[model samples]
Target chain A: MDLQYFAELFLGGLTRGSIYALIALGYTMVYGIIELINFAHGEIYMIGAFTGLIVATVLTFAGFPTLAVLVLASVAAVVYSSCYGYTMEKIAYKPLRGAPRLSALISAIGMSLFLQNYVLLAQTSDFLPFPSLVPDLPFWEPYAHIISSQEIVIISVTALVMILLNLLIKFTRMGKAMRATSQDREMAMLTGVDVNRVISLTFIIGSATAALGAVLIASHIGQINFYVGFIAGIKAFVAAVLGGIGSVPGAVVGALVLGWTESFFTGYISSDYEDVFAFIFLVVILIFKPSGILGRSETQKV
Target chain B: MASLIEIRKSFLVSIWFMFLTFPIMVIRVNTVENVIQWRWNNMIAVGLGSFLLSFVWRYLIRRKEQGVQRQEESTGLRRSIFQRIGEDRRIFLPGLTVAAVAVVVFPFLVSMYQVNIMTTAFMYIMLGLGLNIVVGVAGLLDLGYVAFYAVGAYTYALLNYHFGLSFWICLPIGAGLGAVFGILLGFPVLRLRGDYLAIVTLGFGEIIRLVLENWNEFSFGPSGIANIPRPGLFGVAFSLEAHSRYIYFIVVILAIFTIFMVNRLQNSRIGRAWLALREDEIACQAMGVDKTRTKLTAFALGATWAGLAGVVFAAKTTFINPASFTLWESINILCIVVLGGMGSITGVVLGALVLVLLPEYLRAFAEYRILTFGVVLVLMMVFRPGGIVSNVRRTYQFEGPDSGDK
Candidate 1:
């Protein structure tokens, strides 16, 4: 492959990976905290995009500047998504806390289906043309052939998010409580960690990340529909699993790896079979390395 | 008593929900034209609706808590009504007779349209029972059960398309192919944990569908194959109405056969192995259940039924397409198994009828059917995880000395 073409594909993979990482972070965090797949997590991301679209559409229509519109829309998406995540946990999952893992999973699937259809019922089912919110910087116009400024923004924002998240986890009391809860829920409660709040906070944070991803990707792609979440959700879940679910850093690495795989395979092989390749990759990985790249192998004790 | 704190709590909830629903519900965006349709009424409705619904929500939560507390307080396990009716021979015998009579006479009395719907319901009953083997009995959360169904459907469609094979011939072939596919999937996934298994299966299902959609020369792509003949009787061509009735009877017979086989399997050695596996995989393996064999059997058995149902589905519709078999269909089948009362035949039958028939009849709200299924699933999980007809555990009871072990 030519170097220029290879570089383009690499950046393309990075963009895709960054998006997957954004969503996979949610899955990893939630799985770390509760050990449930949080199947409806994708729906929250879709809702984020829809929310952002609506807010942006109205704000722009109301004569707001593009920058103000972008910031406000992202904020709205985050706030609404966090609200949804909190409510979803309280309504669907909290009651089933002591129930079998399967029950929580089924509920999550149900919640996912419910939210997808809810959006379908509330919004139009057709693909809505999302506005391109990222403006290209004049200075970076020369290298735009390889990577657009929008992509640059996405990568930088994702990096910024990761740094902020790392700092939060390392320094904040809530983050410490989250770590404690993830390690041992009962012990954390015994140590007066307010486990429920920690759980809610985890969901909220995860959903917020998903919302950010949704808004960014939606703007970049320039269109969205209710069905976007299911496929993207599954892909991110695959990334999460690939990185050995429940590990945050693993999620990023896994997403990037998956992104590269899809990008290169589609670039060289067949675009039609891109999804098939991803799934097959997942199945194969699961078969041989069930623990994932960064995940520790867990053993069950009776 | 109208409690002020409760009202205040509900009011806050209403406000939160109103805010939560504001953008999506209130603003209708037409991106094509840049026009915004602001429906202020939806927000008001949400506010009012949530305010009222929170009372019911709290009441249900309170009642659920009380019910759990009561169950804990009681030393003895209280049987559900379905279980009680099932165990009492006098009641069970009569109920069975009545149900049998209804099944026999209902087709004759109902319109052809109703028969068609009933046939579909029976088909779901079969699919649900098949899925029950993997999910309910074996504790494998398979989200790709429809892949096997698609395998069955496509097998029949392709066989008939190429060889002019009859339905009677394809039925077993379809089922066998489905079992083969199931085994193929089961072998790799047998070692994975429950959730991981679910995703892999989902991936597998999507892979199958995508291949079918893209591989035009192989499966004819998305336009689907049509004009496939229905099940024949002695090389005779039946009228469309007759075909519908014939399919109904065929489905009814197959559903009964499925019920019979599953019932027998329930107490069989392998069935018990599956049950043990569902309860605890480690314990089951430790008990020398041969986890791989039991899991594979469950997969094969489940897929076999799906295959049978798949052939019937293609024959009934006289068409097959990738769209017909989606993850949603798999979820629908899973819902039937779970909603019916996992591992309970009666429950599956009941669940099949309600889930299938309600949607069929409610044509106006048909659009909302899936949305309703989603809600039903959440509600069912929250309120009654065991399902509509919870399985009854067989227990040994000692009688008085005179009637000891009677």
Candidate 2:
């Protein structure tokens, strides 16, 4: 491809990858501490988008300013999704904390299915149009050939969130507690860290990030549905695993790689095989380097 | 079972339901008219249903607890009722004979619709038995097992569609292909453990489905291959009127063969190696069990049965599609194996019957069926992690105290 075409694909991929990275962070964080895939995390992202849509719709009807409406909608989405993440942990996961890994995995799958059907029964299964929250800026007209204002917003917002997350994990007390718990839950507990609270906080932050991702993706795609979570969740999970399951920066890098792969594969190859490419990548990675691109290989002692 | 305290618990449960149901169930987005829909009735109904169900469930548990207290006085009767049938060959022989006769007469006794459901259930039984070797016996979690079923179905479907092959001819081909694909998929994941192995298998499953869905030249794409030939006995066609009975008998035979094979394998040297591998992989390896060969054999054997089941399934349905072999179908088979008590053949059969037939009977609440499955899965795992008919540790006659003297 020519330079301009490549740039366009890159920009498009960056936006898509940003969303994947946000979702992957949730998977990585949960897996890091609890060693559970938390299969329902993707549903939280879907719920976040729906919550944002509702908030945006209500605000639009109320004739609020675009900036104010966007801010409120994002806040509402984050709040609602965090609630879902918290409740999911408390209800489905907490009881099976010390159970066998298979039981926990099964429970997570159950929760995923339950939430998917619950949403299906509550809302119509058909796709609903998501209200555009990106404010139209005439000044970006010159750059519109390469990247839209919406894409710019998505990329920048994701960058800012990642930076803030980095700061939180590095400089804050809660971050230390989280890291400690993930390293060794028993040790952390003995060292006076409230492990449960740390785990819950990890879920909250992870979920809030996913909500941000959902809102951004919904605005970009202009549509949402109940079943969207299943595929996106799986893809994001692939991205997470590709980056090293518990590594934060690895998730971002892995997601970007996946996004680029999907974009280019769709452009060059058949679009029908876009999802197939990601799954193929997962299998290849597992076979060649199962620790993932950025993850450390775990050694089990007999 | 009913008491004032029970009513209070039910009240608390209803309140919990109200919080959970109100937001999602009450305010719904209506896509058609572009408006929000108020589903107040559904919200209240669900909350009330949860309360009533939990109450009844609690009442049953209470009754069971009370029954246990009274069991001491009726110990003799209880002992007679639950006597060790496994130890007595005479009692077991008559029971087996009666069951065998009943199974042969089942299709004739039931309606055609029920017979058809039984056939489907038996197909799952065969699949469950196959998966039991890998997951239950080998302790390797395979999430993409439906891929084997797909391979088997498509083997028959394509052979029949292109060459006009008979079911009997294509059945072995399908099974052979299934085993080949199983080894192909299993080889790479031999070094991977547990969840990693599961995800890779799942990815492989998706890859197979994607290929079938997209490769129109080979597999007919999304439109799927239709009008596939059905299985027949000799020159006489098992036509529409006798369709259900013929398929039911065919599935019964296949299921029996699977059970017989798995039963034989479980006691053999390789089966012992698999059991040892499941208990402690390091020890099994130290004991000179070739991990690669044993695992591959487990995968191949498991896939072989799934292939046979798939051939029967394709012939019974007389059509094949990528949609029929989704990841959900794989999970359904996995659930049957796990629910039936992983290593137990009897448990697998019971699990398939209950799971498959229960959904068919609850067709009135079709939409709620999957939701119920989710609930049932979680409850089963929570209460009985070992499964419905958890495998009993085999006791060899040589291990008994008097064996040394003999």
Candidate 3:
């Protein structure tokens, strides 16, 4: 009955979901192609945020305009995160290509830990204040109570990224190769699709999206830290799993569901065990529907 | 020995790595003071590290490929040094005698501080062996193993806090409770596929920890239950130093028991069933193995050890907290099992020793313990998933069809 509170929670959920979707897309895309959970994706996001903060701070001190600083910071985040993602695959995942699935998974976990510490060692472990890049919109000031301008910008940017991602997957030659590879790697390789290149590109694109998400969220939250990636990565992985890991639309939808679940649960019920409740929700869903809501059940041939 | 092309590639790698680490490694920004400190030396370090490591990495990868190819081509698997030593009674008998003698004299030879450190290593050994059953033998990746360990720890802490129960009474109970929880977790994730188990267990671990953290009344919140008494013998009061030795010996005995039990279990039918289940779930079921029973036993038995270890952990530290039992703890145990050699008893023990003691002794490298663990894990999985001691499968040597006919 309370329209404002409901709208607030709804919008809040939407914002959270958008970020989750952004991070989840990388996970879903990587998992789709390789069937390996890119555990370091979250760290890549953290690195992006750190890079963004570093770039933005430097650019601002150099007397750059707000718009240029924001643009440059975001560009730096995307470019650097993509590079890290690509390098991580080449180093960790590529060598374990024919190994048991768990080996790659463990290696991914190792990579995750390594990246987390790498950032921690390089940057301060304490939370650094992130510069809010989203400017105040003149017209949206009236409705700022329900949803802030930052949230609006984040959601819109996320939506735009998703739309572009969808278009790329649907239309581009690389996208076609990616689909073919994910469907059947050997078949794609036989057709001279350059499976390795496709896999590398997938990681790059996924990392780029996650970096964009990290930049948006970090700016909105107004702080950044090395540990942020661990939890965010886990949540995003949850979202990816919730969405049917290999499916892009599934990831977005799963993220939205998870976001709403967290928002409404915290809004309506006890907030102390927010993470606990989210995890419990995941476990319950997995028990009843192991394939995930939007994911197709993979039938093992052997 | 390297070609020009290889050297050039390595140089390119160094350059790429320098550029890659440029923003984070080379730049440190202070927001409040607004000082952008450029640490350009970090770039050189990155470049050099990548350049040198790239050569070694490629060489290692090449060796691994050759090893794999050789293994595929050979009918008889080449036993690793550890395996050969294990199977050869002449060397094995002497090695066992030496190890036993060394283990018995360990506490007496070392100071209280060293004993405490050795106790900690023993704690990890117990935890690793327990997990070895689930992840290594049963083919289940239960990342939430710390939950069981937590259950064991909290059981003692709470039971002692509330009912004034002693450590002796609570040890069995903790181990029992761990098994019960294992089955509880196991029953739900039974139908799910292998990869799903890792995530769900991860969630389960987080849930347990979060519950303990938030449910202040139940788990005393994050500060945790403190001042729990150490394990006692015949109501005898011992000095702090003596208590340390006593607890160290207690851990030694329990660790030996665990090793004995796990070693036997590994050879048992149930253990074989668990192995088969791990190797191929469908094939195991086709062979009429009760996949459910095998998986459940693996989980329950594994938890029992973790539970026993947890009780000791509580008794040793005399403090319990949600923070102590984190996902990291579970992963730490996993590192030991994985780094040691998944299914090898000696490997797990050696893994525990190297992982726990080396860091303790090398105090300077303490800060980089986890960083090294990360590196070790990735490198181990990539290069030697079989670990330091590869498990040697029991081979039945008889006759081929043609040989038998001849």
> Could you give candidate 2's per-residue lDDT for residues B285-328 as a string of tens digits?
99999999999999999999989888988998988899999988
Among the numbered candidates, top lDDT falls to 1
Q: Rank candidates by DockQ, best first.
A: 3, 1, 2
Give candidate 1's whole-model lDDT.
0.91
Each candidate's interface RMSD (Å, one decimal) is 1.6, 1.9, 1.6
What are the per-residue Cα lDDT tens digits for candidate 1 across A170-257?
A: 8999889989999999999999999999999999999999999999999999999999999889899999998889888899999999
Candidate 1 residues lying further than 4 Å off, grouped into runs, are B398-406
Ten residues in a row with the worst lDDT in model 1 chain A?
A98-107
Ten-residue stretch with the least lDDT total in model 2 chain B: B75-84
Lowest summed lDDT across 10 adjacent residues in model 3 chain A is found at A99-108
Ranking of models by TM-score? 1, 3, 2
Reference A-B contact fraction recovered by candidate 1: 0.71
lDDT of each: 0.91, 0.85, 0.90
What is the DockQ of the complex in model 1? 0.71
The native-contact fractions of the candidates, in order shown, are 0.71, 0.45, 0.75
Backbone clash pairs in model 3 (N, Cα, C under 3 Å; residues 3+ apart or in different chains), count: 0
Query: What DockQ do you compute for every candidate structure?
Result: 0.71, 0.50, 0.73
